[model samples]
Target: MREFDVQLLTDAVRRMAAQSNQILSPDVYAGLVRARESEDGLTAQSILDDILRNADLAAGKAMPICQDTGMALVFLQVGRDIHFQGDPYEAIQEGVRQAYEENYLRKSIVKDPLRRINTGDNTPAMIYTELIAGNQVKVSFAAKGFGSENMSQLAMLKPADGVEGVKRFILKAAREAGPNACPPIVIGVGIGGNFDKSALLAKQALMRPLDVRNCDPFYAALEDELLEQVNNSGIGPMGLGGRTSALAVSIEVLPTHIAGLPVAVNINCHATRHAEEVL
Candidate 1:
């Protein structure tokens, strides 16, 4: 067995949280650049340009790309042979706390859903862990802002509804989100699984690089189709109206009961910020 110190995890998470907020990941940055180049509408092009500039400025100055620093989300792939020195969850939370406090990232997490009191240090990161065969621990961190997150949708459709139903629902969600979720968004789609699992899959999908496609041929084709349909909505950048409404659509799928077809859409803004580290 390989032994690992909790402090190592803590420090890694802290650095990820801080760095992710300040830098737009390369895939996302590249997507934005492509959007800016392809956008036909002058206004939409201008908006895309501004977004690129904002990303550049944030990276150069070590500042958050958006004011809404977002809730801390940590995805961990733990090796079966690895042993942690302390409670991994607590270590992750500590990293979030330190990052938020030291980096001056906005404190957006609240203690309770209805009570509405700030958590102060962005503690208790939403952590998800999966055990794998290797000896290294892989961490994927995303600072998920609510403007886009609030617009996400989940639906349980009849298996009879099939692909058509899924397509319609996704388009409807994008149309409804229009200006609200921020245009030129990255769409993370989850198909199959139960209701909650579908949602989790959708959220996880967003962490994937924009350039990558689902391994399944069917899902990969669906992603391409959905991207075309969403951009055709002409919602544009910041919802001003153009052909670049969405930068990319990523879909993830899992087996589900025959009676149900659960689908979730997790919308992420142009500043889809995330970082990863393997140790």
Candidate 2:
């Protein structure tokens, strides 16, 4: 087994937190450019252009794309062939706590739900772990802001809802989210899984490259169909009204119980801040 240093994980998370706040991935930038060209309405085109400009400024200045730096959400896949020398969660939390304080990232998380006191540091990140085959650790950081996270939803539909049901639920969720989750969103649809799996998959879906396609042709077609329908809603950029309601729609599926279909929809705004590392 390979022995890995916990400090390596801590340092990686720190740098990733800084980088993710400033850089908009190339895939996301290209999607906006392509959308701007195809946008029929002048207002929509202008909105896309402004977004691109903002992205450039943010990166050039090395500033966060949005004021809400977001609560750190880290996903880890640890290989069974490797051994962590210390408590993995403590290492990650320490890294996040330091990153928030040192980087001047917003401390948006609250310790008490009812009292609503600031946590001072964005500690206690929502961490998820999985055991995989290799000797490496893969970590993905998603700074999920409250506006979009609050808009996430889950539904336990009758098995008969099938694909059509999923389409309808997604459309409704996006429609209700109108302008709140930040328009021109990247929609993550998780289907056929249990409630928790569906939610996890929905969050995981956001990690995909903005322009990549599902390896399965069937899922690819579904994504295309969903994208077309979502854009047709005319939610536009910032919800002002246009053909660019959503930048992309991704669907992740898993086998489910025969009795029910659980679908979760997670939305991330134009500032889809995420970064990944392998150690």
Candidate 3:
């Protein structure tokens, strides 16, 4: 067995949280640049250029790309043979707390849905964990802003609804979320799971690099089709009207019951902030 200090994990998470807020990942930045270059409308091109400039300034200044630093969502892949000195969950939360406090990132998490009390430190990160074969622990961190998150949707579609139903729902969600969720969005889709699992899968899909495609040929083709349809919606950059409405569409799927097909859509703004580390 391999022993690890919880402090190390804490430190790693803290740095990742702070850095991710400022630096746009290479894949996402490239996607933005591509959008800017290909956008035919001068207004949309200008918007994409401004977005790129904002990202550059944020990284150079070590400041958040957006005011909403977001709720910390941490995904952990722990090795089965590894052991930590302290509670993993608490360690991750401590990291989030330190990142928010020390880095001057905005604290957006609230204590309760109904009471609406601010958590102050952004503690109690939304943590998901899985046990894997290796000895290292991998952390995938994302600061999920609420603007796009609030526009997400999930529906338990009948199996008869099939792929066409999924396509319609995704397009409708994008059309409705136009301007509200921020345009040039990244669409993460989850299909073929139960209600909650589908949502989780959708959120997880956002963690994938924009350039990567689903391994399954059918899903990969579906992703291409969805991207084309969404970009053709004329939502444009910031929904001002153009061909660059969406940067990418990613889908993740799992097996489900014979009678039901559940689908979830998670939308992310242009500043899709996420980072990863292995320790």
List ranges where model 1 is wrong by over 4 Å.
none
Which candidate leads in lDDT?
3
- C-alpha local distance difference test of each model: 0.92, 0.88, 0.93
- For model 3, how big is the CA root-mean-square deviation? 0.8
- For candidate 3, write residues 1-279 as lDDT tens digits: 999899987998999999999999999999999999888888998899899999999999999999999999999999999989899889999999999999899989889999999989987799999999989999999999999999999899999999999999999988888988888999999998799999999999999999999999999999999999999889999999999889899999999999999999999999999999999
Q: Candidate 1, 73: how far from true, in Å?
A: 0.2
Off by over 4 Å in 2: none
- What is candidate 1's lDDT per residue for 170-278, written digit by digit as tens? 9998888898888889899999999899999999999999999999898899999999999888899999999888888999999999799999999999889899999
lDDT agreement of model 2 with the native: 0.88
TM-score of each: 0.98, 0.97, 0.98
> Distance from true position, residue 226, model 1, in Å?
0.6
Kindly indicate the candidate among 1 and 2 with the higher TM-score: 1
User: Higher TM-score: candidate 2 or 3?
Assistant: 3
lDDT of 2 by residue, 44-75 (tens): 88888888898899889888788899989999
